[model samples]
Target chain A: MIRSKIPLRTLAVLASPALLLPVAAADDYRDYRAEAMAMVKRDFQAKGIAGLDRLEQDGVQAVCNRTGNHPPADVVRRLEQDQMASVRFPADGKLMGDWKEGEKLAQNGRGFTWTDKPGLPVGGNCYNCHQISPKEGSYGTVGPSLYLFGKKRGYGEDIQKYVYSKIYNAKAYNLCSEMPRFGYIGALQEQQIRHLVALLLDPESPVNQ
Target chain B: MRARFILAATAGIALAMPVLAQTGASADFQKFRDVMEEDNPAELFEARGEAYWKTPSGPKHASLEQCDLGLGPGVVAGAYVQMPRYFADVDKVMDAESRVVHCMVTLQGLTYEAVTRQPFSNQSGTPAHVNVVTYVAGQSRNMPIAVPQRHPKEREMYQIGKEIFNFRAGPYDFACATCHGTDGKRIRMQDLPNLTRPEGAIKAVQGWPGYRMTGGLMLTSQWRMNDCFRQQRFPEPKYLSDTVTAILTYQAVNAKGQIYRGPGIKR
Candidate 1:
C-alpha cells in the first residue's frame, strides 16, 4: 500500500541528481558536517554571555564528535592522558572540604548560560545527572547513583584524589562521558571541586550514610 | 497483635514515601492527559485559526483563502504532512510555520516583523501564527507523514540536519545526542528519545503544535527547537531560519510513515 503511494517518476528524478554528484561529495559525512557547522554559525546570533566561541569545538570535543564518541584506542589513551595532565590540584594538597558547601553546589544547576551573570561561582549541577544524596527526593540517573560512594569504596586518600580529579576533568577517565568537565571548563573553582569530593567521600555525608 | 500490624504498615508507607512522590505526579499527569485528549482545548485555537484563515484583515484587508500551502491556493488538507518542501515561487524550502508566515506577509500585507513579533504565546495571549499552524496540522490528522525529498535542496537539508544533530560544543559539551542519542535513558524522570532511529524520531515529531496544559498556552515545534538551544546554553537561532527548518526536515523525514495525531494536548 505504501509502495503504491510513492510517485515513481519523482523517485526516478531523486535518484538521478544524487547519482550525478562527484564520488567524494556524495559519500563524505565531513562535507556535510562542515556545511552544517557553517549554517549553525551563520543562523545563530550571539546574545548575552553565549558568544560565538561557544559554537567552536576544542581538540578533544572534535575527536569525540567526528568518531561518534568512540575514538580509536590509541587516540583515546593519548587524549585521556592530555586531559589528566590539565588538572591543577590545589597547592595546599587538601582534596576534601566541607560537605555542607558541596551539598549546596550539587543542588545548584545554574551558570554559563546566556541568562546567568559572569564571574559568579558556578554550580556543580550534580543532582541533574547523578543520584548523590538519598535524602534528595528528585535526582537524575544519567550517571550511576553515587549513594554510599565512600562506604562502598573505602574512604582513603587515593579514592579522595580520584573523586577530586573526576569532578575536575571527567574526560581524563572516559573520553566521551556525558558528565561535564566542571573545573576544567572554569565552571567550578578549586574549592568548589574539593567540596564535591568531600560530599562523595566524607563518611558523615548523607551519600555515605 | 493489632498494634504491631499497624506499626509495621506505617513503617512500610514511610519507606515508600520517596518512590511515591517521584512517580505520583507523572501518574496523575497521565490521567489528566487522558481526560484532556477526549476533548482537547486545542480545538478552541483551531476554531480561532479557521476564523483567521477566512477573515479579511491586515494591511491589505485580504483573507488567506488564496494562500498556497503546497496543495494549491486555498487547499489546506494533508498539506502539513508533506511540507518543509521546496517552493518554486521562493526557490527555497519552507516548513508549515514558515509558509504560513509568508502568506500572512504577501497576501495579508502584514510585515514580517509584525507577524513574527511574538512567535510564541505566553501568559498574556496566544499568537496568531501558532493558531494557524495548529489549524493547518489539524487538517492532516491521521495522515502518514511524507515530507518530500524530491528537491535537491530538500535532500541537502536532511544531510545538514544529521550533522547538526551530532555536532557537540558549548559549556557542557552537549549536543542533542548527549541526552537523546541513546535509548532507554533519561534525565531525572523525563525519558529521553533516541532520535537517530525511526521509533525515537516519531516521538520527536508526534503531537506538535500542541496546547501545553502547564501554562495553558498553545505552542509549535519552532518554539520547542528554540527552547532546546536555550537549554543547551547556546544563542538563539533566528525565527524561520534555515537552521531550524533543517532540523525539522530531518525529524519529519525520519518519521516519514508515522501517523500524525494532529494538534495534541501536553502536560
Candidate 2:
C-alpha cells in the first residue's frame, strides 16, 4: 500500500535530506533542497555537449550549498585561505598580458553552453556581473564596477598580484563571491588571465583612462 | 503535359503567397509598436517612484523632493529623457543612476558607498537604492530624449562612446555594432535593437533601469552597459563612471526625438 502511494524514486528523493544533517541545520530547508535536487537530477538528461557529471557537486560547491551564501566567518576565512594556496602564479613572475586580447575576453559571454564543444575554451562572462569598459552601453551590475580599476587601485606590484589572484580564484578573496574562478576551473588559461590583468591594470588601457 | 505544368505553377503561387504575406506582416512594426503602447509597466513603477520621492527615508529622515538633477532643484518630470549629461556641480557627466546617487548622497546624506553597495537587485527584494532609481526613471517616462550635448565635455564623451561602440576586438571578433549596428537581427527569439537608429535607441535606452524578468533584478542603464561588455568579453566597466555616462549620452543623443518610455520591462 505504501509502495503504491509513493514511487520508489520519490522515496529515495525524500530520504536524501537526512544525508545533509551533520553539515547544515536540521531545518526543513536542507530537506526541501535535497528533494528538489533529486527531482532535478532525475529530469535532467545529458545530451550532446552536456554530461551527467555536471550534476555532481564539488567540495567548494557542496560547502556553498550547505551554508547558503553567508557561511560562518571563520569557516569562510579557512576556506578562502585554502583556496588562496591553490593560485598558480607564472613561473617567470610575469602577470601582465595584452590588454587588447584581455578586452576581447572580457566582452565575450559565449561558450560553455550545451551547444558548445567540450574542448573549446569557455568565456569569462565577466560583464554579466561587472562594468568593464566605458564604451559598452549594456552591462549587468552584480559585481563591483571595474572601470578605472587600475587607476583607482594604482598600477603597482601589489595591484598586479591582487588582480592576478582575483581572476585566478575570486573565492580566495571573498569566500562566497559571485565571481567565477576563471583560472581555477581552467575556464581561462594563465596567459588569458594575465592579459585580463593587463586590461584592468595597464595605464594605457581604457580602464585606467 | 501542358496542363500538369500549369497546375504545378498555380500550386507554387499558392504556397508562396503565405510566405509573402508573412514578410509583409513584419515589414512594418505596427503590431510591435501597438504592443508597446498598450500598457507599459514602467509607468506603474514610475508612479510608485513618485510616491517614494515625496516620502522621507534614511538617517536624516529627509525626502528627495528638494534634490536637484541638473535641471535645477526639485524637478522630477522628464529628467530621465535627458540624462548622462554633464553636471557643473559634480564637474563630471553622470548617467541617470550615478546622478541619482549624487543627489541621494548630497540631499539625503546617504553615502555613495552605501548607495552603490547594493545598487540594484537581481532578485525581488526592494534593496533601497533600486527603489530610488525606479522612482526617478519613472518620472521621465513618455518624455522625448534630449540629453544635453552643448558642453565640450559632453561632446567628447559622446565621441568616446561612439568609438567604443564600433571598436571591434575579441575571440569572436565582435563589437556592439556587429550585432546591433544593422536592422533586423535577432538572437533566438529576442530581437536585438539597432542602437544607432532613433527608434532602436529609444526602445533600448528607455527600457533600461528596468526590471529584468529573467534575472529577477531591477537593473540600471549602467548595469545594462556592464553586462553588454561582459558578454562581449571586454573588461568590466566602472559603475556610473565618466565612461558609462559617455556611452549613455551617445545612446540618448542618438535616440533624440523618440519619446522616452522606460524603465520598461524586459524578458
Q: Which prediction has the highest TM-score against the true structure?
A: 1
Give lDDT per model, in order.
0.83, 0.67
Candidate 1 has an interface RMSD (Å) of 5.9
Off by over 4 Å in 2: A1-209, B1-44
What is candidate 1's TM-score against the reference?
Answer: 0.86
**TM-score: model 2 vs. ground truth:** 0.51
For candidate 1, write residues B46-157 as lDDT tens digits: 9999999999999999999998999899999999999889998999889999999999999999999999999898998988988888999999988988999998899999
Give the winner by DockQ.
Answer: 1
Per-residue lDDT of A81-189 in model 1, one digit per residue for the tens?
A: 7778878899999999999899999999888777788766978889887898989867776788999999999999999889999998898899888888887888888
Query: In candidate 2, how many Å is residue B88 off?
Result: 0.6
Q: TM-score per candidate, in order?
A: 0.86, 0.51
Output the worst ten-in-a-row residue range by lDDT, candidate 1 chain A.
A1-10
DockQ of each: 0.35, 0.01
The residue ranges of model 1 lying beyond 4 angstroms of the native Cα positions read A1-30, B1-28
By how many angstroms RMSD does model 2 differ from the true structure? 23.1
